[model samples]
Target: MPPEPPDTDPGRLLAELIAIDSVNPDLVPGGGGEAAIAGFCGAWLAARGFEVHRLEKRPGRPSLVAVARGTGGGRSLILNGHLDTVSLADYDGDPLDPCIRDGRMYGRGAFDMKGGIAAMMVAAARATAHGPLRGDVILACVADEEHASSGTEEVLESFTADAAVVTEPSHLEVTLAHKGFAWFDVEIEGRAAHGSRPELGIDAIAKAGHFLVALEELAQRLAQGPAHPLLGTGTVHASVIRGGEEPSTYPAHCRITLERRTVPGESADSVERELTAVLDRLAATVPDFHYRLARGLHREPFAADPEALIVRTLARHAEQTLGHPPAVRAEAFWTDCALLDRAGIPCLLFGVDGAGAHAATEYVDLASLDRVTDILTATIADFCS
Candidate 1:
């Protein structure tokens, strides 16, 4: 069970969160997991009179969902934020030590995005301050966003709402779309022979060089094909390559991994087809060219309807709070909002300002955190009540 809500300032709550190491184990072996933080958040919500449910799809990996039960009369809203952060590999100072300087709270997961979690948590508490809500407000503090996103993936199996807001760092803008990425591994096979025997050996590395050239051509063609108004054209790039053992011997195999950042219209199948076309052309001309293409991980691109109910509602509230409309922008990184949107939740991304997530130093803008909390609090009251 989660502990009782601690009597502390909102910024201090964020500091406490930063002090806890919820680094994704997938990113850093033996890194602290989300169980402790999830428990704390769940308890905090429970203390605020929410119905808390602890979900653990994988062993030791937990996500907390706290719901304020409603009369089933108004619209339900989901506030989603992940609990895991990347490894602190090269951090300049102690990544877990939270400090305040120049009106910024500096620490790991502070900006990207314990600050958002703190804001949403406080907002939920304040929304129900007067009385019970007409509609349910679900607080989804999940795990595993940094690596596989298995936490949100697991939650989507059952939990849902009319709309959702992912509190990912967005510089306080409304992020309506983001690029998705797919990883593909290509293997080229050739006959091994002594390097001196050029006629007897088929060079797989040389063949890969041809594919690299073709990849550039494919990139050019893709850049010229079409573009998303917000996301622009898709992109493809070679990630890593491995082949050859000794200089005296012709390596029998070459393996290459490539990544494709997809825009709205692209899919894994489409990407595979495009790569197959490249290999097909090479096969027609290059002698002894044999290879196989295998698809790895893929996350679909997300694009929210700018006119969505959640979008309009958040915008109105944000404008009322900021004295101007929040900018609607696109993100280069992906978020769990894509999964929520795919499940018909009409979710959008929003968060505070700061930088240096997974970097040497990190922090969240203290003022932005307070502003986001106030905006979200008012938004919940207006939309759910």
Candidate 2:
């Protein structure tokens, strides 16, 4: 392996980054947001000769865009990573302190993605070190990925690139696809009555149970249906359910919040149609199946062209770095890659290997971090030039 750069060494940059509290407040209230961390990243990029731009979509959340300008004959490239992380409420160790044990750096955002951010930052700087490229290399360090991803959405309002790479931790693989999701809340209505008058009271919770049973059947059907080549079958499950006020009185209403994970072809509208069909069948069979399905948030799934120049460039560099072709696969989770793809930027997801995101103990593999940095450095140079 080549000697690591001192100023932007993956481990050191990640440790310094992890030391700053940049938890997304929207996910868990009172936790630090991305303002301070964005500032730190902005300054770091500025020192490396990037033209930095700071943006704040909301009051507290901020995102930084650092551009290494080029001579304007080649395709522009965007290296993107989120700044905000999930809450650190129940973490086992000090979530901020970077602990190096067994060559892994443990911290709150260690695996889930500060490692990717560090790698991309260093890689961008290294790509532009020798001389300016023929096209710009943009590093978009955005905020609120753990929640709504408002940061990336805001940045996309004005920024455009020929191709983009979201450093979203795919075990250092070139992730070409991933699942999207739609959230919905089904409210079941019932009549309240005293416990003594069982005949008069309608049990909303009990009715909800029937819906859950039907949902299980739906899940079974989904499993039996056609699957994506890489993503497998899409699925659904109840996330939060609430009903009943007291043991004595039957609950007047029940609310079940569900998330439907959609593959490439499935969308929120299609998913809603699936749920509506199930509900329609239930309403026909079950007595008084009074319910309302309210739509929540929906994020589109991402699928990149394997033959795209950016994908080919990264894959070639990855094979050279690993001595084998990097595995291309799909992720079960969503990322800002979809947003970029939607904005006409063909993007792929790639990042370092690690474990335990938003879990008890989080760490990023040190070796994998360096490998990702090296590969991305080469990829940035090749794609932009």
Candidate 3:
């Protein structure tokens, strides 16, 4: 294919990416995940003469790594974003439909972040067309970000970069750090018996109620203390619970799912241990009140070095392009940046301006999209020059 246009308008690319549904592994029912978006990115990058590598962690879920070679003197800069989005499966409207209204792009991943991916793509294309760069530009569009970051983990296992940028929805600001998350399911076991003979059996539902109270206390304590400078301390909340089976019979078992946010310097293992200790203490009170804890989703907190070259370069570019100095912030939610950071890459988060991520009728401002593209292009030039 003839070399793709140098000035690859990001708007067109955003529309194309939004049209592809690459919902994450957890969100997808049958586990076929992120393949469509990966295919589109791979094809698009390859057609633009980039050296593209496609990796699959599972069948039909692929991640793409595209490289533009330069003078090869300095370390490579990794421009990363996930292809998978939070499932729109629950959405009543068509998730794949990309709508433009009043200069805004309305779609499932419009802001968080097909828009960011489009900016990266356009920046890479522009840099390639401008001739050889001083350093390599690596574009990593991965799968499973909305779930467990399997694709990012795969990248971390095999690849290393000097610095990295994760294109999450940061409202065009620099995100130097973010809190991690741990999800778990706790099961309390008890004996079941007829309602008329309630004294003959132990009630798991009652035990669960006590445990929930303890969890609430734990959450409150963490919230009031242990605040981090950026990400704050931590948080815990019981998201779901199930116990009783029938009204006529006493329930035998209860399961509660919880989500815990961890700040920097906190480990998922530590959080699990703390929770287990709480359960053990409760078990001492009730002999048959034993509970088992199983971890589900676990991600560590990530904080990029504020003085890293990539972060500084991007901040400067944002100021130049948008005429305002980018403010550094922390996200309460988690992203694949944690995976990359653990892999020893300094990862900063930045993206287009938007709101209502993962909510209905998600939209991204057209002006923000344009500004992101311009800033990204300039950052790439600055880094590779």
Candidate 4:
């Protein structure tokens, strides 16, 4: 495909973006990182009079922080979207070949995010086309939103805005809250001995079974516990488990890796304590239930005030653009909204109507794409005015 002509039409721009392979290497080994895509965005924005600044502290993993500097004294706004996408291997068709049928555009990243990126780029360009606003309109086209949010993390180090809108796919709804997650590894220890000798050998895998049952009970307790208004109850599940070398010998070590999805009022510390309590009880009750617990990566859940300036502004624009008040919704998955919120920038998630994010088939409704672009353009103009 040829380079897209410099224009504000989001659908056209989305087709161009989907043609480039920006699969996250962290998610898929040997995957194309954000260098090519980031460069394309920087050039595209720079051509439209944005002051493009590319941040690539992690070598090839670059993130562009393009700014349309406002006249001054007005609240700045950020339009954020991820450039990196999930792997293309599992996609049903030619993931790089963007196709438009009916009203949906099918391709990898089209719905997962590149749709939002195109919309925000066009919105930013159109919003400031006539003249700059009183405050800056910053476009953060960041990398690694699929595996880790290191891209947004780096962007926050240098730039900030009064408010932000993470254009993660939301079916055009206003997403105010979503779940967070923490990973943990549990190692169940046991003495290795001959399998034929029942008394001499303590089966680590069998002992680990006890912990698995406890984990299920814990999940059930969480499900029956107090739930968040939007996100509902927190939950836990074992993701990966490995133990023993061969069937003939008593497996000395068993490892269980689990993930806990959290709602508001929960944190890594809380999850650690919960797991520790469970393990401690097992140690006390089960005769040889020795184990070690370690917490891994975690991100906090996000919730935005419905009345927040950004949320209200975007909602208003969406309502006007869609002919109905945008529905307020929440997600089970996490996004960069939490990072933006943690950075002290009031933010919320809103984006084009779409489906099949990271699935075998992915698509974004073309009409929804145009509507989101219009809504964002108006919101940017209003919020930065």
Candidate with maximal lDDT: 4
Question: Model 4: per-residue lDDT, tens digit, 1-385?
Answer: 6533459779889999999999999988899999999999999999989999999999999999999999999989999999999989999999999999999999999998999999999999999999899999999999999988999999999999999999999999999999999999999998898888888888999999999999999999999999999999999999999999887899899999999999999999999999999999999999989999988899999998889989989998999989999999999999999999999999999998889998999999999998898899999999999
Per-candidate TM-score against the hidden true structure: 0.96, 0.98, 0.94, 0.98
Predicted candidate 4, C-alpha RMSD: 2.5
Positional deviation of residue 108's Cα in model 1 after best superposition, in angstroms: 0.7
lDDT of 4: 0.94
lDDT of prediction 1? 0.89
Predicted structure 4, TM vs. truth: 0.98
Give the whole-model CA lDDT for all candidates, comma-separated.
0.89, 0.92, 0.84, 0.94
- Compared with the true structure, what per-residue lDDT tens digits does model 3 show for residues 43-142? 8888888899888867687888998887878667788888877867655478788878898988888988888899888888886775868888899998
lDDT by residue (1-385, candidate 2, tens digit) is 6666579687899999999999898878898999899999999999989999998869988899999999989899999999988888788989998999998999999998899999999999889988899999999999988888999999999788999999988998899999999999999888899999989999999889999999988899999999999999999999999999999998889999999999999899999998998888888899977899999999998899999999999999999999999999899999999999999999899999999988999999999999999999999998988
In Å, residue 42's CA in model 2 sits off its true spot by 0.4
Which should have the higher TM-score, number 1 or number 3?
1
Clashes of 1: 0
Clashes of 3: 1
Could you tell me the lDDT of residue 119 within candidate 4? 94
Candidate 4 lDDT trough over 10 residues, lowest sum: 1-10
